[model samples]
Every structure is written in C-alpha cells, then in structure tokens.
Target: MEKHSNVKSRRKHISPVFHLQTKKEEDQHITKEVIKSVRRTGQLNLSSRHIATVPEKLFSIYDAEDENTVDWDFGKPKKEEDAWWNINPLSHLDLSSNVLSEIPAQIGMFQDLLVLNVIFGIII
Candidate 1:
C-alpha cells in the first residue's frame, strides 16, 4: 500500500498561502495604507465602490493634530526650499457614484476644496 506523495504535498503548499491572514486583517491593512497615502498627498479618489457612507478618516484627517494625520501648513517657514509643506494644500476631491444619503458637514473643513463631483448618487 503506497501513498501518493505529490497529492499530499499539493495541499501543504496551497493551505499556507490562503490561511495567512483573515478578512478583517486584510481590510485593516488596506485602510492603513489609504490613510498613509492621503496624509501625504492630501487627495483621494474613492469612486464607483458602492460605498454607503463616507469614510470617517476623510473628515478627521483635515483637523487631525496628531502625528498620524497630515497637518497641511503650506505657508509656514521652512528651512528646505523644496519641502512638501511649502506646496499647495489639497484642492480637489471626487466622490462619485456612491450611495451617499447626504454630504457630511465635516467637508467644510477642507478649506482648499475647489472641485467636488457627486453624480448618480442619492444625496439628501
């Protein structure tokens, strides 16, 4: 009675890859990455995702005083000539095709918001 070694090896190889992380862990990782990028660029495009509500991070990011969020101080004194803070603040945001019931009041915090697009979505 000889067992097939190849069949057993296949299961061992595939199980580890799929069982590496849970769904919650993956979602947290993605959220963290998005926050990091938004802090640096001050711009975000979350369109056509069928999101029911806006991410809370978008509202708090503008006023976040901690080290995690970006404090966009564009006109402050800088020793470096090409510092990122010296650049212009966030000026645009696109939240289209999402099932948003109403625009959040926190949007007003974005003083640099010049253009906003919310088409084909429920807005109250």
Candidate 2:
C-alpha cells in the first residue's frame, strides 16, 4: 500500500502534461533568443537547430524601418576601426538543415539579400 501511494504521488508530481508544457516553453525561449540575436547582428545561423517553422520576426525585421532606411555603402573603403553599424543590410541568411516545410511569402522583404541557404530542409 505504501509503494502504491508513493507511485501515485510521483505520478502527480511528474505528469506528461507538465513535461509537454515545459518543452513548449523551452522552445519559445530558444526562438526568442534566436530572433533577438539575428535582429541585432543581422545574421542568423540556425543550421542543424531542428527549427520546424520560420518565425515571423525573421521576415519583418525591416518593416518598421522602411521610411527611415539608412544608405549603407557596401562599396566604400573601410577603416580598420570602423564600427559594425556600417555593415550592409542583412544579405545572407542560413537556414540549412532545419525542418522548415516552406519558405514564407514574406521572404520577398529581403530584396537585397544575396544568399539564402535552405539546403536539406523539409521538402514540403
């Protein structure tokens, strides 16, 4: 009877429902970090990260700045101490080896994007 009670208590404390919720929370946290980092650095390397869906933030990072777009000169000579703020617009995006089933239509926002690596992602 004591063993059965202990098992019942453990079951209550370690339910599969709790585990599923925790997993969803963790995935959201990771996705937030990825979006924040990519927005700040203008680069995202999510290769082999098991990402299933392309987040919306990745597609709309430039929408708010449409009217205030800065003209970054990618052809100008750069000094050794030049700040990274002069870097060109996000030109390369690597989404290789992820689980992405489709490239969203919002991808058209990246007009200046030069390279988009979606190698080995989901065929659908």
Candidate 3:
C-alpha cells in the first residue's frame, strides 16, 4: 500500500442575520463622566428622535485623518479620539431629541466620541 496526502479547500460564509443579531445594545448604567471627556475641545450635535438603534452598516464610515468639520445642519456625532479604540467610534451612538428627559447612560460606550448636537428638540 502507498501513502497518500489528502487536502481540502473551500471558502466559508456566514449569514447576515447572525452578524446583525450579535451587536448588543449597551446597558443603562453608563455614566456621563466617562462620556464627558470626549465632549471637550470639539463641538457636539444632538439629533431629534434618533432611530431605535445605531445600524451595523455605519461601522465602515471611519476616516482617521479626515479632520473635516462636522456639519452643523446635519448635527453629526463624531469621535474625539485620533486612534481606533478597537471599535468604530461612530457606531452605536444615541442622539435623542430635546424632548428626552435624560440621555441614556448607555451612551458611554462611545468612549472616543466627540460631538453631540441638538437638531429639533432640546435636551432637557
């Protein structure tokens, strides 16, 4: 009998459903202090009536050295850090209207976030 080597090769793919379902929302205990550091030096924009959750698709919008000024009309939210914190600073953000009683502490997950502007409502 002669010895023989066997080899197999195939590309694998994962369902989008599984990928979308895994990014869990942050908990409610997030503190303002942890998120406050990024608020300094840069301006903020808070949107009125934010969608239920930040989309996973937005994770690809990173531009480390873009240095582009935020659009005031759009009231865009941005990251304060120059480095990637093993996460997309733009994703998983929350910008509710001024009508909101309080900002969910869960926003602390945006550890490197920068701006938070109010679009239509006030942040009372």
Q: Least lDDT summed over 10 consecutive residues: which range in candidate 3?
A: 1-10
Instruction: For model 1, give the 10-residue run with minimal summed lDDT.
Output: 17-26
Q: What's the lDDT for residue 71 in model 3?
A: 51
Q: In terms of TM-score, which candidate is stronger, 1 or 2?
A: 1
Best by lDDT: 2
Cα RMSD, model 3: 18.4
When sorted by TM-score, best at the front, the candidate numbers are: 1, 2, 3
Candidate 1 whole-model C-alpha lDDT, 0 to 1: 0.60
Question: Residue 99, candidate 3: how far off, in angstroms?
Answer: 2.0
Cα shift from native, residue 81, model 3 (Å): 22
RMSD of candidate 1 to true structure, Å = 10.8
Candidate closest to the true structure, highest TM-score: 1
lDDT per residue as tens, model 3, 1-124: 1222222222224333312122242212122433343223222233432333433323323333236754545333464343234333433243544344445555565556555443454445
For model 2, how does the per-residue alpha-carbon lDDT over 6-101 read when each residue is reduced to its tens digit?
Answer: 998888887442222233432553455555455565676766656666655566554443477665777653553233554346667888977677
- Error (Å) of candidate 2 at residue 9 is 33
Task: Report the lDDT of model 3 for residue 84.
Answer: 36
Candidate that beats the other on lDDT, 1 or 3, i.e. the better one: 1
- Model 2 ranges with Cα > 4 A deviation: 1-41, 63-87
